[model samples]
Target: MKFLKILEKRKSIREYKSKKLSDSHFDLIDSLSNNLPNAVKNQGLEVNIFKDGSIISEKLDGIIGYHGIMIKAPHYLLIFGDENEVAYKMTGYLGEWLVLKLTKEDIGTCWIDVGANDRLIKEKLNLVSHKSVLGIIALGYPKSDARVSSIYAENDDKLISENRKGYPNTDIEYKDNIVSRRKPIEDIVFLSKWGNKITAEELDTRNYDEVFYYMRLAPSWTNRQPWKFILDGTKIILYIESSEQENNNYELIESGIAMLYFEVAMHGQGIPGYWNLEKLEDEKKYGAPDNYYYIGYYTF
Candidate 1:
């Protein structure tokens, strides 16, 4: 299967077989973990791989419903980042990339967040302070036909109508199932500025469709897809929409996941980009804030 297809087919697999990750697999994980692309070159993000059966078992203790499934895996990857601006966002992006890469290696992975304490895990790894544990990822061969959450498909006509109201002159392709839908290009791609819709004919022919295709497939909470991409020649800016409700950290996390998807899709296509802290003033005109966090920038 093609690389992008592997990404699309990947699911968060929880169950695992008894088989262990080979030396080569370990090497691949190590290389990818150690060599992850960072916004600041050679940043201090750290990843520790645990494979010893005893240590893995101990880590899984007291996590109800995940007792065996969590530790049964042959290996686990612990990702940590130093406390700083964009650290959590960067970790989220790179973490999701590792998950996708693991899928290509025919390994199953599930993201573990709840019930796992960074303090305890840090002591095990001898990691000092000034760094915070991000989360643990469980990886191994799957125990055939693992349970996966079902995706609901949106109605094409209805979605198109919604896009017509929100955007214009853009095209979108929908996969023939409840699992995939995309906003028309008009709804997203703007013409040199916000609210100025760009037509399909105005877009660059190289990789534009592919980038949008992969991004449209990215997972989001409640499928809100509150991300907007602005393309100016070699530069791409991401503008995030704030939630109407208060205390919406979950939405921010979901946006982080979307940012990861965009970065990976760009990398897989040989596009080089970097995350930045600078905010675009035009973004505020499009419903974003002047002082909101700038997720990243993509450069050709």
Candidate 2:
């Protein structure tokens, strides 16, 4: 439940206060970046968080982000790694973990959508790294008018689905509500197999109601929640829906974000587990469809 409070209050802050992040906050970020979770190292993904985002904000303004619109923030972090599927997923995992950690410190964070023009983007940003830019995240103290608890806040209870138990005592009532929309638990969680939907009672009986409830709150590309979970006995298989068209890199990143959210939610409930993304060869063996890409699984 430690992150539930943050998850409730966590919203993408596009418009930020002009003031830069404090020195202590900067140090905290440096520490976290250097001491990333072991999974990041194991995946061979390198995280390069460049401070002084003004230069990036200025240079790649019209090149990156949707509709060539970039968010101006005091700080920004970019993930660079080999051009691979799991690279994109782990990028999502690493970026979202930092976002949540920053959220815990009341530092606002927003993942800016990067276009598929990777080479052009690297050229515009004056990057030397041969790795692809998995994602970009803007960080800053949100403007008072733009703060979640102020003008743009959503009702906290509504964040965890209608009357969810994750944040039971939260009663943050704010005007100018920005409704937080999430797909229902049954919509994303499959029972025993892929596409085998489960009911609310089923989730409760399997002790997964809270995990899927809060996991649905994870941020995704254009709010497209592309990931799903299959509860296979003692294990949970993850799948991300792939578009028919090319450039489905963002979908893999969304898979990573969902993975992180599920892990955090499970960890909160005293369930410790890590995703075994090495099960790529088991996709056909598991009887998954072609459209749904197998990402990984968690065995507790």
Candidate maximizing lDDT: 2
lDDT of 2 at 179: 31
TM-score of 1: 0.69
Top TM-score model: 2
Backbone clash pairs in model 1 (N, Cα, C under 3 Å; residues 3+ apart or in different chains), count: 3
Model 2: how far residue 147 lies from native, Å: 7.6
**TM-scores of all predicted structures:** 0.69, 0.84
Worst 10 residues of 1 by lDDT: 164-173
lDDT of the structure predicted as candidate 1 = 0.60
Q: What tens-digit string does per-residue lDDT give for candidate 2 at 232-274?
A: 7778998888876577777887888888889888988778888
